[model samples]
Target: MHALATITLALAAVVAAQKVGNLVPEQHPQLSWQKCRISSNGTTSCSTIDAEVVLDAEWRWLRNANSISNCYTGNQWDVAQCNTTASCTSTCALEGADAQSYRDGYGITTTGGNTLSQKFVTHAAFSFNVNSRVFLLEPGETNRYQTFVLMGSELAFDVELSSVECAINSALYFVAMEPDGGMARYPTNEAGASVVTQFGEDNVKQFFIQDGKRIETPAASYPGFPDTSGLSLDYCKSLPTNFQDAEYFAQVGGYARHNEALRRPMILTMSISNDHWANNLWLDSTFPPDRAGLPGAERGPCPSWGNGPAPQEVERYYPNAKVAWSNIRFGPIGTTV
Candidate 1:
């Protein structure tokens, strides 16, 4: 009887451990991050800085439909806007290849302070894309905002999509500078004028963990554009409405196996979230060629151009396309976000 009781206790302890391992991450109450910044002289001289961005605080409107008007006027923000929208016309009009149309009627507002939320317009004809933006943490600087991730550094955040159906092509990624100090822009001279090519395949790496599976690849390797084509239903279904942890580590040394120059300094641009009408816009144009042949090679819920659903149909089929990110933290490899 004594031996049987001891065996039962051991089994109970194993079951408890398994339960603990299966538990998901609890939401963090506060978000914080730190990084090292190079001085304006562009030398090795640097300073370690710490900063906080209110993930749960009010987020000011960074850009809106009216903001796109600047695209036609050749303004400072025009270049960035045009690149992001993949405007086909020289004047950056709303109609053309890979063009995105905007209606001021749609906008996102923070709900409950801690969660950033947006409601998609029910009107069939109204569609638009906006990136709720945030700048990199560069404390105490006027003209220069320079920060870089070294080997063994990690970037992490918790995010969730409202609904996979509504968010056709929603994504989160990091944009950074090349070793030459030049920032990559969209619409490269490639055949499809792919955005990933313009960003320089080596300059950007996206890491994602979905339903117990981990996927890490360069943005350019994603065939056409960074849409939802390659993602699995289990992955999409798993996205939480509240925050869930995601991360990317700066493995420059790993990349240096291909290009040695990456061992030098490179500046980090801001992280971003954008919504789109097509879930797999750029799945056909992957780098290294192998990614194009992966399973679900021709799979995604979004319709083709002429076959797309009407406005009302779209509203009914894909409702509430938004994603919220919080608990953004970055530091050494073991740092938690």
Candidate 2:
């Protein structure tokens, strides 16, 4: 799991660098979670753990450590502030978030229990926040990320999307990431705790919660796969998709390779975002503008311009949108169900 960078997420890609600017004063949010182990007899033992979260470097404020000038601004590096990559790394610091900063500056809030709410757009008197993403961290170690192995395990969590309008995505998932955040390999990666540099989110769940009720669509609801709601390698291969990227996914490794990633240790992440680059069309509307009438092209009812840039329709239209997640549980496969 990783911090939400810009709401405009890219296609599949690896963000490897250990964020050169994390050396500055940092503050992480305290989020609670529970870990459970189930016995063969169906008994369960659970422990409450205090966890922390870190914002992705992309969204953190990067300023010259000694002065008030910006180290990187307007999507480009300030050469005077950072003459070179190495120099910039040592000179700039990525500021961390406090309680007020987390809410007003990033639209993030948490309670005493296991819950985190991320807002799509946050507006205050002097500042504005568009979207947010954060990664889970180990309870005691601020620089270390918490890890989970989910092959035979199940993760249960309730999500409230009543405020998450169309074209908005409030997602949570697991990814294979180094527990130490690649700090050992990249000595300069102070914030490399979890930046998502490895395999993508192949093993994941996208769900919504309503009025605290269990919101679920039975596999029986889909006429195509009436017998099973689960997806496997066979299902992916049999499903027809002419998208070039989908083809490339098969050429590189396909679901088989992606499936194996689930057997490894993974980090959990969550976010509420909307696409500024693609308008999230790929997730909910006709993509490629040119493929409007093609099959698999018209995926949702949203107009091509449905979710515009943050300053446009997205912010102006849904300033009050948000998503709440709570009642999280993890245990043996059937135990949670």
Candidate 3:
């Protein structure tokens, strides 16, 4: 089975990077952020903020079949759907402390681009690597908060070689969350103004468009976007050569501090569509629970874009999930914009 899914993706990336580097954002602190908003005719302006994203990491089930690890279920997966299990560990520790205070208010950093180094290595050489769960947006974004959503992780396993010397590890599964709602702020404005100012220059750059790839934008001059006519990004390394372009990349730093928060900015006007692939953002389960966008027996219904299980297992393994849908923007100066 592909050498046991590359030894379970190298023992789940050395036990989830030594247990998330011995977790210490004050001993288990999810992201956080409270309020934001502003709009003015006084100087070509726009503002908005509401950063709140959290994840109390402890959900393990990358894969298990060779023998079955007793049906794993690390639970807690509520990006705001709040399924259960104590309301998904209290909405993943209050949206992981509001995505770590929207990445420390704005001075975010994960040490620049082409990421994958903590020892996993990847400048683009291509030896092999995987085990990425996404969430990386560009710095200090005002109001328009710019249509957010950066949740990743699911290469499951690859990185080969278990011979000549020694290399084969895989086993990652962790979960935890149980703090209830107590710090949910963000709702002011009657004179108590502070709608997060600072405009244009927060650019924006993030990636992870895999399948058939194209993600272009090395731009000579172009970054328009009013209703779309310029800005091109969905993958472009060079005339379609079977690009999966997104091979795990992270650049997100802790948001709005309290110990790293994030999630304030939802004006929703961001465009980049292959038509919301498989329902919307790779949903899986073989959707039969009422079927939606892509579950074709002959392409009848038309609405299984985000939850899967049909359309012949998403067209027999994502037959180009709508041309591997993509559009991720911001990138001209300083690489990842």
Candidate that scores best on lDDT: 2
What does candidate 3's lDDT look like per residue over 284-321, in tens digits?
23334343332222233334343533323432343221
Q: For residues 209-244, could you state the per-residue lDDT of candidate 2 as single tens digits?
A: 445554443342333433443455544654554332
Candidate with maximal TM-score: 2
Which 10 residues in a row give candidate 2 its minimum summed lDDT?
A: 4-13
Stretches > 4 Å off in candidate 2: 1-25, 124-126, 194-227, 240-246, 306-311
Candidate 2 structure, TM-score to reference: 0.80
**lDDT for residue 288 in candidate 1, whole number 0-100:** 19
User: Where is model 1 more than 4 Å wrong at Cα?
Assistant: 1-134, 140-146, 164-167, 178-279, 282-319
What lDDT tens digits, residue by residue, belong to model 1 across residues 9-94?
Answer: 12222222111101111111122333323345643222234431211001111222333343433114356544543332232312
Local distance difference test scores for all models: 0.31, 0.64, 0.21
lDDT of 1 at 134: 29
List TM-score per model, in order: 0.38, 0.80, 0.21
List the candidate numbers ranked by TM-score, top first.
Answer: 2, 1, 3
lDDT of 2 at 256: 70
- Alpha-carbon lDDT of model 3: 0.21
